[model samples]
Target: MPEKQRYTLPTKAGDQRQLGELTGAACATLVAEIAERHVGPVVLIAPDMQNALRLHDEIRQFTDQMVMNLADWETLPYDSFSPHQEIISSRLSTLYQLPSMQRGVLIVPVNTLMQRVCPHSYLHGHALVMKKGQRLSRDALRAQLDSAGYRHVDQVMEHGEYATRGALLDLFPMGSEQPYRLDFFDDEIDSLRLFDADTQRTLEEVEVINLLPAHEFPTDKAAIELFRSQWRDTFEVKRDAEHVYQQVSKGTLPAGIEYWQPLFFSEPLPPLFSYFPANTLVVNTGSLETSAERFQADTLARFENRGVDPMRPLLPPEALWLRVDELFSELKRWPRLQLKTDHLPEKAANTNLGFQKLPDLAIQAQQKAPLDALRKFLESFSGPVIFSVESEGRREALGELLARIKIAPKRILRLDEAQDAGRYLMIGAAEHGFIDTQRNLALICESDLLGERVARRRQDSRRTINPDTLIRNLAELHVGQPVVHLEHGVGRYAGMTTLEAGGIKGEYLMLTYANDAKLYVPVSSLHLISRYAGGAEENAPLHKLGGDAWSRAGKKRRKKYAMWRRNCWIFMRNGRQKRDLPLSTTASITSYSATASRLKRRPIRHRRLTPY
Candidate 1:
């Protein structure tokens, strides 16, 4: 047996303690324990979004407390587009819940926490509560939705979109999982149904839904006035030619409008720290000071890079983001703990509580017993062990694996059902496993037993609009990527450019074909373009423009496809069968070739003498 590794964790968290020697899922375990014992809200600020999400998922297994992950916009500081609808919905939902949350676990990335969010009252004020029998007017609701930045679409397929048709009102509220169809009878709502966007079928019946604003900023007349007034005050420009000023004045919400959210608000937007209670305990991993500094640097870089877009003037980065020192000052308001996976820094506190991660299962490739180490650990471990897999299928598979190795284990659901000296299987996810020496409990995660897992690709929440636009917009396409043009063959995307044809300027996609041939396709015809996927792009054949090779290849492809569609049949018109006889075969004196040769020898004497 190898020497047992040990980590020092405090039994009770100090006002400002530095936790050291914690790695992988053990960090989540410690945070969960802190949340379980602490009376106030526990905030864990991770260095990045992925780490914060992993910790959030893992911590849920350890404690029954509410674990909320407030993610970032996943966009640049001065991007031309907004975040996805689902991401926006999630952020708004978390912001709405944060103020009322007395005690729970809130996990956030350092950058997310650094940005200022809309105040609680802003959302609460604009929100509308609808029930089964509420009196409503379609026109009034439509006007309100428009003011709230909700698009009046023909169908409510995404968040912050609403549609009205006669007595039925459909709206997908921000911060909601599903779109809702409100069936109204005359002036009152008769029924409310949550629906599936793809199938357009009602999934469940709901009595009430809280309608929050689509954008973080307001788009109403008053808010727009406030924004324009503030813009004049801030920029000191009147009747500016900026596209943002012109559009916002007309109450049209433009892309990447989040940068100007502060101007729309009557009061100053509040930081994330303000949402938490006075006694909120903050647990942070990694160097937040450095992260903040790096964020500020990236913000400045973006600010500089976006200077070319004269139509959309950017407010300074200081207005949008909190500085490193300001972030640190906010951290000072809460009881802080710095988590580390390596050796403690010089002169740190001497807090101690032993928590050891499960040792790696060392198995040789040619070894006879691959499960030998795991069997031994299960047999020797004194505390109850829980085998956590990523899902139910994994749980059952792991159960079978254990059973086949002559280690029968009980199947359980929750951690509370664990028993001393027993091995159990459960559905849970943890990056790694750990042994709590103080609690006499051991958790053997999938990673611990089977090694690293292949993470599943995240599926997009939004449904595909159409095949023509499988890629929603040209923004999805990048330079140097291969794309297929409907009329032309495969070409490499160069970039977007404005070309004037017949005295009119228009946007077009620049595609480079063979021999540096360029084809400028109209932006409106993006439907005819798609991303190419012919494996190993460097090896892909690029056909020359205005050449017959592409047409010939297309014809051949179409022919093969047509043949395959008809049961992949092969037309063997000249093929011979077992029952058929050849015409020139000399069999039973009925050979046509033999007779013809004989007649040819007789030639002119009796020309047509070859007869039956």
Candidate 2:
């Protein structure tokens, strides 16, 4: 391992510097080193979302400071729903923390950087804080939540929602994972506790809670007036706008109203670059020009083919998003560092105040016996060696493999644990691994040592909403749209209505079928319903209610799907078998073992097998 190299940045704040030919991990390490010496926020701009997320994880290994990701909202033209709540909450939280935190890292994609967001002043005004001993009337609190865009519900199950039951109030605040149960003793607060939504069990008590607004747009009277005026002036009268306008006038927030965020403010929303302080350091992982161009082209293509009805009326692209040229102009205001894996352009290199070359430390191919290769590599190097595997079982197996080769490597659970050791081999868990020759460190992941297998990144330990439930919101349903029931064939969706059966009251989705037959499905069974999606809604066929014909059609569909799946599996299996044949010879037997090990290390990418 080579000694870690340190380069000096230019003296002036606005000067640009280039760090060329560095891999993702190497660039992250350099950023971490620079962050250690700096005193303020560090912004790392990746070319795309995947790279932004990957670099965020890599940078986390180097510093304990807050590392935040500002993800793209991913709004497409005529999208029926707002961006995911998690994505919105993360962006707002980062914005709120940027001005206050002593040091932090913000990773953002170019698309997110170009998108317009609410001004810092607007967000600061909406943020609310509560303490255990704080005194507040229930009526006042409820009104405040409603004005801040939180929905009142009978039960709190998701973020941006609150429920009140007598003296107890349950609320899941934005920018937080769990909901808080606030027990109030009349006007004075009694206690505050965080509870699990699944079990309704209290986890722990907290003294205070800081809450960010549930929606990005303000819901105050003045803001609503602004939205109403702008919306009426921008487009001709349409059914969708009229319906939304009525809801706004009545002080009710309609679903997917976030699409109209630009109208909520009287002044134009600012680009993300406006939030950063003047002295804050900016690092571009690749060329911003290329990223901006790609985003512009993709957006234009999506807008042209969206096929949304004109009456529904989407905001023009310019009103909601920034132009590529404008984003590039904003990029010029920051003191910048450019990290490039490939050769830098002559014009950029000449204009940069200083240039530093980072060594390339990529392993092109692995040898036949990885364990033997590892032993030899360790003997030839005098720096730290970290072997990262995905699971505890694999970590234990790796330790045994090393023991079989008469080598004892230290077991490290965290990166901080490896700081004191030099010329040591440590095993830990990581997503992907690489060797940093500049830091004299080699991070050999299970995949790289064994071969590429299907590896799925470990999901965070949070409850995930079902995919079918996320496809479309119930509010987005129209009276005449086609819908599909898992057990029944396609039917035309009638309006939802309250129904009482067996002395129980519930909301049901009414579906009309052939011969004017009707089927009422309980709202609790929403997971069983899906919007008919393959073709135009008008072309969908209506099924007869209580007919065996629908069952027969379902059976045929299942059989066809099973046959297609079987053929795909057989093709993949035969291809793998043919590829394995080359490693069967005596000269390549060790390579075959390495390949098999690699397959085991790779995360399984295949979907779960189901009985047809």
Candidate 3:
């Protein structure tokens, strides 16, 4: 080595100044010092392709044909899902192999282009350093993440994502190989590593290397196999249903055929899919100043404008894919990102080409512990209370407890059952022989876990009830009292609103007979109706819908949700109707049917044989 020197460049106060605040002049000076000492091609690594391109382009000015970006080279594409070699050769080999006619400087984004790069091949085996604070349990870290201003970002990699399955905690962070695995020791972090998301096994260490945002080998064999196995069962059921449907249309199957056997149940399918696809995700790298600034501004805007929480936790890493053709094309113009060469093992190089779906790791949910804390929160409230929970088991337990504590048996209603039955089921098993005053207690239970896997269930019962039902239920004043609302179709009385609108007036609500419509009934209409002949819970304090209490409560809930949406931008899937159209038409069948019908028809004389 000859020598090395350090220098700092002054930032120019202009709009078009380079983002890094350095110019090509300074870069050329640095390259000259390195070139004089180096014997061969120089290598550069960048966070993104754009930076790689900039560095390569800048260096090219001094040494006419010196810099060459690997992304600019042409290579066969490989399917990322299947095993394939991505790295073609080292920077030295690439330069040595170049034709005599192609002599120049070599520049490449080391990580992005090293498709063949795997720690397994490099180090063979090296034990990663295991530190105590470094290994955090999903639940423990989630609390920290809550304070970190990170949540699920829809378009970015799952940065602060956590998920649990029984004892296993999966976290996919930016630049880590595989998602990090935090096996629990009684809800504590026992061990951690970048494990294969599919296999759930610790990735065999190739080399002790710094993690990257992009995954070289993200697919785990287990997740893929699980999907493949389940697909056949799904296809068979679909095929059978199609046959049955066609037969019924032809008048072969009876009208009650559908009632005999339903196509499939809804509860189990969502979790199966949830385990894999949601794991592999790519986060936006913020490669550009404008992009980074946009993200920051959005965060601030949400906090100030929407009252969003800034202390949410980090979401999981998202697996972003680069198409082979597009990858090659962009490299020619801007050679910065390291696009891996098709140097995968023979088996991998010849693999089929297509987009492989990877699990978005951002959705890993912390376990049931957090909800326990929330339950304790509701216990502190002594007034006419309204609480919300996620789990059905928790709801049932609460209902049982409230029945024993309160006197009015009719006032305690379990809303979960009402969701399935399409009506509110009031179970006021109060010990005081039905306190027929006002319907006071209202409980709302919500679970992110259930919502994660509820979409695939064929039954309507498992589907989330509309927010309106919860609102309308709060408007009710008494059990067995008939109440009507403009929005909700119709529902029996359940309870009154404990949700306040902060200090705003005219925001109180009464439970009504409707499906999931919690009517925000105004408090000014207290004198609109009389109690029913046999209504229970009638004597409790009548609340004016538009009172100050309603306003305070409503604002609080809004603030929490606004913060949540800002942090976790969970994208909702648009439902599509699956219609099976005949791939081929049969014109001959139509002609045959017409001719056969004509032949079968006989011209009957107007008078004689009709009497028979």
RMSD of each candidate relative to the true structure: 18.5, 6.9, 35.4
Compute the lDDT of residue 445 as modeled in candidate 3: 18
Most lDDT-accurate candidate: 1
> How many collisions per candidate?
0, 6, 126
The lDDT of model 1 is: 0.71
Off by over 4 Å in 1: 1-14, 236-242, 343-350, 455-612
CA-lDDT, candidates in order: 0.71, 0.67, 0.31
Rank ordering of all candidates by TM-score, starting from the highest: 2, 1, 3
Instruction: At residue 65, give the lDDT of candidate 3.
Output: 36
Candidate 2 ranges beyond 4 A from true positions:
1-5, 239-247, 250-256, 303-308, 343-382, 413-440, 453-470, 478-612
On lDDT, the stronger of 1 and 3 is: 1
lDDT of 1 by residue, 275-315 (tens): 88766888898888888788889988999988666677788
When sorted by lDDT, best at the front, the candidate numbers are 1, 2, 3
For 1-612, candidate 3 gives per-residue lDDT tens digits of: 123222221122111111122221233323434444333333343444545555554444334335555542121121111110112222212322332322334444323332322222111121122343354455655544332222322111133344556566555543232456656667445555567533346764332222221122111233233333443344332334334333332323222221111121211211100111111111111233343334344434443453221211111111112223333332333212111212223331122111111112111123212133333433542424333322343345434433432422222233222222111223221111101012222222121212221111122222122222222112235565554332232334554444434322223445643234445444323222333333344433333433444355557987997776444322211111122212111122222222222222121111111100
Q: What is the lDDT of residue 187 in candidate 1?
A: 80
List the candidate 3 regions with Cα displacement exceeding 4 Å.
Answer: 1-138, 149-158, 175-177, 197-201, 205-612
Best candidate according to TM-score: 2
